[model samples]
Target: MAASVQGGRIGNLPAEANAFVGRQLELAEIAGLLGTERLVTLTGPGGVGKSRLALRAAHAAKAGLPGGAWLVELSELRDPDLLTNTVAQATRLTEQTLQPLLQAVCEHLAGAPVLLVLDTCEHVLDECARVVQELLANVPELRVLATSRQPLGVPGEHLLTVAPLPLGERDDAVSLFTARAAAAVPSFALTDANRADVAAVCARLDGIPLALELAAVRLRGFPLHRLLEGLDSRFDLLVSPARPRLARHQTLRTAIGWSHELCTPLERLLWARLSVFAGGWDVEAAEFVCHGGPLDAEEILALLASLTEKSIVTRDGDGAAVRYRMLDTVRSFGAEWLAGLGEVEAVRRRHRDYFRWIARQGEAEWLGPGQRMWAERLTAERANLRLAIEECLAAPEPETALELTGSLWFFWFACGFTEEGRGYLERALRRAPDGSGPEHTLAVWAHRLVTVVPEDLDAAESVSAAYVWLADERQLPVPALPLTGASLAVRGESARSAVLYGRVGQAPAADGGAEFFQLLTLALQAYLLASQAAFERCAAVAERLRTECAKRGELWMRGWGDFFVSLAGIGLGHSDEALLSAREALTAKWRVHDRLGAAAVADLLVAAQAARGEEELAARLLGISRRLWHAAGLPQLGRPDRTVFHREYERRLRASLGDARFAEVVREGWELGPDAAIALALGGVSDVSGP
Candidate 1:
């Protein structure tokens, strides 16, 4: 049967490009088990179609899952510590707090009936078991379907061993081979002339799906008889006599090895070097990381295209967004070759350096028109970035870890990875040498900013003192000084914070300073002005910042400027203007995936609606704001000024709409998903009915 697609449901599960040949019994059994069990694992050797079957089951079961079926691909994730974060990211949970990620994931899943497919768990088996056990224990309604080479020994777990496809007449094995062969050679068919040869090839390869698919591709270059003859010689030469009972596994490996031998020398070398990358890579990354010695940078695109045609690399997306990735089975094969060739360390270092360059470039370009593009590109490369950091930490001198982590402060802060960023920064600092240079200092400040609990006044004071000392000793302006001021303001030291902001603005402009830092200073200054009840001055500063951002096509700081202007408008009793500015700020924040900023903007929206006598909408917005704040893990960012407005709005809303009515509407709004709540706030929807 062709791949199934349920109406009215779309998710992260990838679309199957080819027909799903068979496995009726297995699919039915899996469906039955899913109905009765919370944890079902499909265990099989590599290339035996475990992942394919799991995805098919997930797509078939998507309609019954209220929270949707999300597939978390774990083949690229090497660090056990990031398992929870990976799952949270796949499920679209934007964590903005320093709270344990697993706790946040559990909370997010507790409210819905979700079907989570954890694919390829063998690399991190123990951590996967622990996380799965914890999730099942805490989230009563969540069901986990895992694909691994072995079972994840959690309690109440069900294991289903996936065997090779049957090779009987008209069986799935023959059908799969036929379908793929037709795709490879469009004129090919299962006629009497080639029927026996096709069946023999499938049986020879033990009916392993990946092995059969590889053999089918060979049909384009060789006829059926020649292909079977080649496979016979390869299997005879490669299959070891010491492992007769492991025939299926050996068959798959033999097929991969045979395919490896057929490639040109350069193709084999490129495959091994590409193994260093953790996840998918674009053409430019491939050219930079894999080009050296015999391989020229100009030849990478054609090499990648050849690899894609041969099924060694799967190409995805289109145009400038195109990416190439090897399957887990194929990547493992290449990794082994990479190790045997003694180029693992060298290639891995090259990969690290390339990603480090990417980090520096992102930092330098973060305040310009490419801000959104950078945010997206970096988010997509998250797995590779983590791998790069891991490589640095493993190096003898580990100082580069500090630089890499510190440079990503904007990604960690404004792009919704605050918790992950803090963890990396803390790790880098621990491994850093004492008396280290500017990299260490930058990391210290970044860690402080990303991990700071809004209520931690002591930490805020230390951060302030460090910046002051650094600025005085260097006799240069510190661009991040305004951030320290903002931290103080969060702790209710508004008077001291105001002084710091003023000093930073009046300080001589540093040559070639980062525009992000400059705009951030202005945004905080305007926020302080609004908090101090200087509405007109606050509006002026915010407008100036917005105009500057517009000239550069920036979004992150522009969103903050819009938010401050809304606060000033509300303070000046311009309800309509405040409402419009709040919506505008929300649009920008959502575009950049700034969950914390969007949540804060939702609070302003509540006050604006209340001020305009939209009591029912205001009450609903209050409830929506509660959910947003909970997701952000910081209510009003723990700011006294923002909290006062929130509380007063709630009190007035409660009195205007009777207590019973207010409570009812608030509950209704609280039940909405993030997208629905944001839509209501932005006036895209009239009511919060569904996401």
Candidate 2:
């Protein structure tokens, strides 16, 4: 029942992998509360089923919510500063601007009907409360459902205490245990023979879902009677008659401890080391970070299988693409053991080092055939990468933080995480020592490149001078020559920009070769040529760049190449070729979520349509490009040279159609969303005049 909004799938409540046992009453009440309450908090102890209940209730309520329900998992998120960013990402509000992240999130949800679910807020309760309060105040139609050990304490919050499932003759707890036992042992069933033992185990564990599931998995090894005996012996002493709540806590801990005692020494060690990872980790990451010292690399897969069979770690995805994660409660238990072993810092350092290697690999291979794969891989590792950066910053030497941040320039630039990259780069640079080493310089220039604003033309010039001075002093090649050229082009110094681009083209590729940068330089050079009216040379340069990108399976830079070629085609009076290249560029840009590049190509489509005598289409596309420019948070392509084509095309369109009629069509185009606008510009839609 979840609806799609602006190319983003909004209702992302994860599907249940197992059958729902019970909680009919709780589900009904939570659904009813959501219908009335603007802010609902599900407060409970660890492993008390708060998250599962929240997901179920939200999934059931998605039909009434027009904006759809979204889950923002926060168990792995350690930094309170990124709370808003995490929420915005979960809601699919990819604001490609430098504005305050909180403001961006608020504005995106301003008048929209959305159900925002914040999962696992115990660690970052203060920030969650502040964000939830701000969102409720700003967006009248927004509803929040939060799961935490405690309440967020916002003014309008309605706390729903989620207790353990009831234990009775035929209650939820026994039903859950029976279901999981059937999964572990296909012959499992309940009859009068072993029914009493099942009920006793459920009662002893306080009807908590996780403890029951863990107990059920032991059925694969021991008979029902033996499992009950183990629980009674391990848990009976911990029970306290004075405090019922404390008893439940101690019971769950003892159950988990019983599970731990069942594991082999290697499995326990791996579990403890895996606590170093944030979010989830794949098999290769586990093999690297968790192996060594009594645990061999080859033994990891088997150990993982063993732990997974015991329900200590949960597996996600399938086959080769699978990843594993532990429940916060389970991971917290393991973290305690790891700390007791005095191996926390060592394991954390290994985690940091492993991801640092990943960043470098992504950077080195970014310009090659695996660009898209690397992009997706790095995006999936965002949480772990953040953890690595945090660990590095916490260490005595923070220089590795700069190195790691700098190595991800491609991810921050080519992917749609420019705002996030800017934040990390700024932080790393702030903590960077005063050194002119290659790593420090790369971080500095990479920061400048990602955070470049057209308004800061003077700063760009200063950075360019600094790069030149550093290169001369060290007798090294200017690493980011293409960025320097881009800065010059944005400054309207076309001649100097052309010279720098030409030099970049002629220079040998940097050591440890980045073909992405080389191809990008070629694209910039072609654009410079087109702006200078050298249409023939521009077309040639663009063709070479396009061919190179095709060989590498690269889309981001190739899209720029296509745009430059389209611009040259327009200049040379080849309208058909211009339209073809423009469409290709638009498609490529849309695939990569490159909004800025898509805007440029949309503007070119306006000119191409005008050249073909499609006056009405040109006017409509002009308006669409105007809207895209606004959405992209930049004005007029961020350069005068790029704006000239738009200005000239608009003047011609206005002259052809009267001001009143042109304004009417332009207004119509401005109303189309980005997806619809791209479809219209690509000629997939014949008529967009209908509301």
Query: Best candidate, TM-score-wise?
Result: 1
lDDT of 1: 0.79
Each model's TM-score? 0.61, 0.55
In terms of lDDT, the poorest run of 10 residues in model 1 is 237-246
lDDT of each: 0.79, 0.77
lDDT of 1 by residue, 1-691 (tens): 1112336563478787678988999999999999999999997656778888999999999888777788998877879999998998887776487878888788877666778899878768899999999989988888999987667878899988787799965799999999988988999999888788889888877687877877777777788898888875443333323342233335557546644754689999999989888778999999988999899999999988877645577678999878888755567678888899898888899999999999999988988889887887887799999999999878777679988998898888887778788789889999974745777777877777675443454555466555554455445465445566677667666788788667523532433454655676687678777666778988988998899899889998899889989988988899999999998898888778777888788888989999898999998988898887777665456463345676787889888888999999999899997777888888884332211
Tell me the tens digit of each residue's lDDT in model 2 across 65-169. 777788999876879989999988887776498988877787877665789999878668789999999989988888999987667889979988777789975
Model 2 spans > 4 angstroms off: 1-268, 306-314, 318-320, 326-334, 451-457, 462-485, 491-517, 533-536, 551-553, 570-576, 586-644, 647-691
Deviating ranges (above 4 Å) for candidate 1: 1-264, 451-457, 464-485, 495-511, 613-636, 639-642, 652-677, 685-691
Give candidate 1's error at residue 563 in angstroms: 0.7
lDDT of 2 at 345: 86
Clashes of each: 0, 0
